[model samples]
Target: MAVSLWHKKVIFFGGKGGVGKTTCSASFGLLAAKRGLRTLVVSTDPAHSLGDIFATHIDEEGQLAPNLWGYEINPVKESERYTEQIKSQFQNVVSPVIMEEIQRQIEAAYSAPGSEEAAIFDKFIDMLERIETEFDLVVFDTAPTGHTLRLLSLPELLASWIEHLIAQREKANRLMSMAAVGSPELKEKTDKPDPVLATLKRREERFRRAREFIVDNQAASFIFVVNAEKLPIMETQKAMEILVKYQIPIGGVIVNRLLPTDQEGPFWTRRRELEKKYMAEIEEQFGSLILAKLPLLPDDIYGRQALDQIVQMLEEQIID
Candidate 1:
């Protein structure tokens, strides 16, 4: 079946590392722009390649083509931004002693386990919220499967963590009221709202909205790019299962870098035979979700002209 963008507004291209996700995503973004839709090609991978593919610059402004824009989010920078936002929001309300402690903790979290993902997820939520107003199509070239899966599951994990924090904060507030005001109920009927709790709840709500948008087919679709090989196939299969379990819709799988239809020599022949077996396995496993098959090109994919050829091939194979 041909890959179709008729229904989905946001498309994510994700797969095992080194599966040509960057190339395919760039091609799709160019194709969308050529079709007269305003498009944005975004790279969520730490190792950026969108700029390399376009042979130009991609930055926060995201202007890479006539009708297309590009952005590559650096997780470290994003995490810093997220930390600053938190500090700014809380510094005013908390005491000087507590403020200093919070500052220390936030600084210590620069290399925290999930800090990068949390920051990136926040940016992703912002994109999802503004995609329709900003562009007709937004194609995400995400990180490797394991990292991307962890990213997708962040909302669930973060929400639970936030809830636990909120519960603990409430208990502390009750204790504070009992000690100072002599009434546990005073915390509930406080004169002012708790800005700290308010901020956490707001973040939780944002995560929920992003999760809802991702699971909606009309809002977002995830496409897996895989080469017909052992490792890529196994990884893609696991990714598909995880995404499906989360109720995130899978648009289909793109079989990239297939062997040439006609090849000479024993090595080429043997490689093609191996590809055939794996390709059959992919078909048997994914069935109707197999969207397109792209042949391996002779040279490295670079610049607009080469991408244009890929777009043409995609248009031919993608479902109408």
Candidate 2:
């Protein structure tokens, strides 16, 4: 079945490195904007090129066109911001001695595994919360296959981790409540709200919300941009399996950068012939999941006019 992307509130374009994910996603965002839907295209890759494609600087977020906005998330900056938010939550609640120790742990956590993903996911959740109110459609031009896969899978994995933390917090609160039955001072302390528990519950709820949005097929779509090559095709297939396993909605595949059929030279002819074989393999492997085929453009995809061409090509094949 042909995929209809215009209606999706959240659309993700992900694939192997150098497969033109940024260009495709930016073009789609531009298409949505042209259709009068307020659109925001975001780049979650650390090495961002979304601004390069649009010929505009978008370090955080900025208006690109009339109805389109662009954002390039910096992992380091987001991680730092996330860490500060975490540290602020413990202030005044914990004693100075304990606060000092907590600060040390937070510093250690800055370098821990998955820290960057967690921080970036927090920002991703922030963007999701603004959907509908701020923009009609939000397109994510994500990192390469492995990194993007981990980012998408974060909702499920982090939700489970948060649930465990909530459970532990609840258990501890119950123990405190039980022990406070005798002493008036302890009873007063237990009766008052627990800041730590409250923070944990809020984080848990945010993760839950993100998971719901990610798995909602009607609201979100994940598309892959692949080149007519062995590596990209294989990577896309693997990425699809992971998304399916997590129940994230798959929109379709876009085979980008196809060789032009009109080229006359022997080398060009051989390249197109090889491209045909891989294109056939893509059809065999993905079948109806193939959404669009984009040819190699004469010039680099930059600025509005070049991006407009991409919108034209996509509209030709993306009909439902």
Candidate 3:
């Protein structure tokens, strides 16, 4: 009497690079929306091809069709925004004399490894949280497998880090109060809440909820988009294992870019032979989980009509 992950309200499409993740995600969203679900498809990839696939510009709020919506999260822009917000808060809280040094520190922190990802993750969580109130379904067209795995793993990693930071700040504040025994100014300062610590705790809470939505509630489903190539097959296998380790449910796998069945030349014949072997491997590895296999179109798939064909395929194969 329970719903499967495929029927879940949120889905994620991810795999190795150049596996048609963006295009597949777009088709899925369009199909879901056409079925009368208010669906929002979002791209968490820094190099967004989601906009190009849909052939329409998706803004911050993500508007595309009557029932469908889309969004692209640019890492550089998000990192800048995230840094500025933190800097603004620092200016409001810290002393004027320390503001210049604090700004420099903030700038350095923004440039650090993982800072951009953390910012992207913050926005990612925001979208997930809003899905319940805003749409019937949400689909994420994620970056390559490794990046997505790290992003999904953040709640656990960052929560512990934030807790440690909070504990250290508390200890430092207590020590200051003890040292300032009879000084009213220092005592008053220690009595007030540490705004920085408060901010960290708030972020920690958000991560906790994000993790719950992903792991506990089974609200999110991961659908891998892959080609029938050896590398993609191996990478998808590894990525699926990682997701399983993290207790994230996988909905299915989509095999993209199938070569034509009828071939003429020696080159085409040899290519077909190689593709057949890999396709057989794909079936051997993930046949039961396979949702759809899309062909390699002669022309680059674009515009409403081309995407409509994809949507029609999904409706015929799965959703309908």
TM-score of each: 0.92, 0.96, 0.93
Q: Which RMSD does model 1 reach against the true structure?
A: 2.7
Candidates in order have lDDT scores of 0.85, 0.91, 0.85
Our tally of clashes for model 3 stands at 0
Best-to-worst TM-score order: 2, 3, 1
Q: lDDT tens string, model 1, 120-231?
A: 8888877777777988888899999988888888877777888899898888776666665755576455646788878878887888888787777766889999999999
What does candidate 3's lDDT look like per residue over 1-320, in tens digits?
Answer: 43564457789999999998988999999888877888989899888888787677776556777798888898888999998988888788889878899888888998999889989998999888877689878899999999999999898888888889989988888898897799998888888878888887888899898888788545778889889788999999999998888888888899889998886899998999899999889999998889888988887778778888887877777741
Better of 1 and 3 by lDDT: 3
The true-structure Cα RMSD of candidate 2 reads 1.5
In terms of lDDT, model 3 sits at 0.85
> Among all windows of ten consecutive residues in candidate 2, which has the lowest summed lDDT?
1-10
Top of the candidates by TM-score: 2
lDDT of 2 by residue, 1-320 (tens): 43367888999999999999998999989888988999999899989999988887876999999999988888899999999999999988999999999999999998898788888889999999989999999999999999988988888888888889989988999999999999999999999999998998899889899889988988999999999999999999999999989999999899899988787999998898889899899999888888899999999999989999999998788887
Q: Which structure is stronger by TM-score: 2 or 3?
A: 2
Summed over model 1, clashes come to 6
